[model samples]
Target: MQKIPYTTINGGSVPMMILSVFSMITFTSVYGFDSVWTEWWWTYDGFSGPAWWGTKWPICTMGRYQSPIDILPDKLLFDPNLTGVVFSSEKKINGNLTNTGNDITLFVDDVIVPLINATSGPLQYVYHLHHIKLHFGHDEASGSEHTVNGQAFPAEIQLYMFNADLYANYTQAMSSPNGLVAVSIFLEVGKIGNEAYTMISNALTHIPTKGQQHRVHGLPLSVLLPQTKEYITYEGSLTQPQCQETVTWVIFNKPIYITEQQLTQLRNVNKEGGSHLLIFGNIRPSQPMYNRLVRTNINFRPKTKVCSMVKEVFYEVNTVQTRSGR
Candidate 1:
């Protein structure tokens, strides 16, 4: 059953997060990829989908550490060592967006003014953002791979990053220990949209089919992130094939917002040569946590009474500023 929206964890069986519901237009067809560059041509389903991925790469099925684990806020350990991660980059970044057949990724390797790097949280070495991957489902209830208390978000934004401090490139870092970080942000639909998300949403009109490319200039990477800084961290692997167990995952507690119309734009992208949408449900299913240590910096204390008292003293208007981080 779907839970109440905006439910926070104080204690007990209540969910950590449940996004506000809205009606979403449906796309029933499944598309293919034209620019899929993988040697094996692995997909999410059918002939050679996720089920067959382990046959080609043993680590996928054998590895103890895998990514996109469901996060339980109540069970998350409060680690004092976990702190706010700082993101540094040029005022704006330039990149070409591609429908990789897998997901829509923003490749910013070439046009970086200086560099886009994240440091000082769960990361021991600096990691560089190589690309941005967007994952979504056919509808609003189930897109994000990582779930909060078993509830999914509409979509997810992943910073496919590599440890630049220890490795030269993502290819080299993919297999090495402590080589990559999965910086994930949850995406939900709201009334007013985020400017950066709106820009990308509008640009989607140019690339409706697979293997299509569009250039996006002056993208502020910082604007895509949440300012709250509180997050959950764990050691895990890549979500796809050859699932290397060399990743440090930092999932923020706060979610970013995009307009319902903007999300529909993302839902409209196709894979390769079909009327169906590649983005209809491109997200990987959440893997088991096993005995993994899930840590967070967020204070899980009850806030119902505090919010009640504060609401009387200060009545703030419903504006974008209320959600400053997103």
Candidate 2:
């Protein structure tokens, strides 16, 4: 090679030293070398694909192993021994039916349940009964967490209880997977002649609209449970916001009836400090069925399938199918 001029650094002229400095600058991008290096690396055959980019930075995508699943009938199992369903007949408050934002607390008594067996593979935990309450909305079709098939019920009575002993409060039970269980009861319309109606109807006068408060007692919880212990059970999350995935849902197959006047009274309650919350409907769209299972206890009579119930009613009356085909 021809003789080359050596670069001077400090007090020395060293060719290798100059080359080392240049290489370092090239890699570090002290000059324009860093950009060139990045372009070269990114264009390399094995490193240029989307897979490589994804491996480096994952985006919002569902993972097959931990994807979200939907609650379906097949995933549920019914148990019969879980019976003695009773509705409370106590009415604790009486005031303006529309404005009263009273917290109606109902007690569940003699609910005998078993400890959740988490060691049993998929059916690890069995959710026990807890107390339930109502969050009133301003419409006939709203206020419940779920609907029968697709129809929204007038009011939703959320029976709250946890896996822990019935003595435990909601705060304690919600802390763990085995802590809480809620049975949701949807209130429908029409006359069924239930004694429990007096408990709620008596208080309607006190709950007029938003910002009103009423205090009452003696509301029974048993009146809301299905006559048959046969209920569809599944692993689900609380229907409220910040939906925790710890709830074991037991939705009664049978629905309680309410009068049109009673439903109107419920629709006038205040919601979240706003105007009387006119909740026309409250329910989530049915989700896709995953590989989960729903089981019912064997002691009680089997409940009619929700689909069949809808079909029978529609056909019996020869009711014209609405555009939505409900």
lDDT of model number 1: 0.73
Using TM-score as the measure, the top candidate is 1
lDDT of each: 0.73, 0.45
Model 1: per-residue Cα lDDT over 1-326, one tens digit each: 97554454455444333222111111111222222224336888886777677776777777778777876544566666677988885557678888877788888755472288888988888888888889898888788988876778888988878888888888899889889888888887889877777777877888888788899988777788865787878899888777889989888767788988888888889887576746568867777767677776655453321211111221121211121110
Count backbone clashes in candidate 2: 70
What is the Å distance of residue 101 in model 2 from its true position?
A: 7.4
Q: How many pairs of residues collide in each model?
A: 3, 70
Every model's TM-score: 0.79, 0.53
Stretches > 4 Å off in candidate 1: 1-40, 111-114, 302-326
The CA-based lDDT of model 2 is what? 0.45
